[model samples]
Target: MVMCKDVVENIIGYIDAELDDKTLEELEKHLDECPECQVFVRTYRKMLELTGKLRERTFVTPEIRERLKQLLKSKLKPN
Candidate 1:
């Protein structure tokens, strides 16, 4: 079983499906025994779901994208 601290630290990676099988299994086991971690996981998952829904909408206009691109290019250029 994994410790609560480790589980909390890696919870974001787990939610993103970025963990290997061994790590994911360990996290699952920790969640099984820790109610607080379980609640944390549920809340995190809900937040991700909400964010994903919001991301489906187009909030950035094309003019904003061009300005952002120009800003990034200026920032990336060597002095």
Candidate 2:
């Protein structure tokens, strides 16, 4: 059984398909029994899909770029 904390720590790698076979199986088992994690995984997958769709387009609008910059700046600001 996987702890929720470990699942939280590794969820991104699991979504990226970087986990090994055994670890993947363990995570999958956890996901099956964990409704909260299941919701998180589904939302995360949707975010990835939307980002990928944006990437497939040849251009990003200036507004999008500015918003992304602001988001990055907010993240990078010192606490």
Best candidate (score: lDDT): 1
lDDT (tens digit, per residue) of candidate 1 on 1-79: 4788888899778877999999999888888899998888888889888998986899899999999999999999999
TM-score of decoy 2: 0.58
Q: What is the C-alpha lDDT of each candidate?
A: 0.88, 0.86
Global local distance difference test of model 2: 0.86
Q: What lDDT score goes with residue 43 in model 1?
A: 88
> Per-residue alpha-carbon lDDT of model 2 for 1-79, expressed as tens digits?
5976767889888977999999989888988998998888888789888988986785879999999999999999999
Over 4 Å off in model 2, which ranges?
56-79
TM-score of each: 0.58, 0.58
Residue pairs that clash (backbone atoms under 3 angstroms), model 1: none
Name the TM-score of candidate 1: 0.58
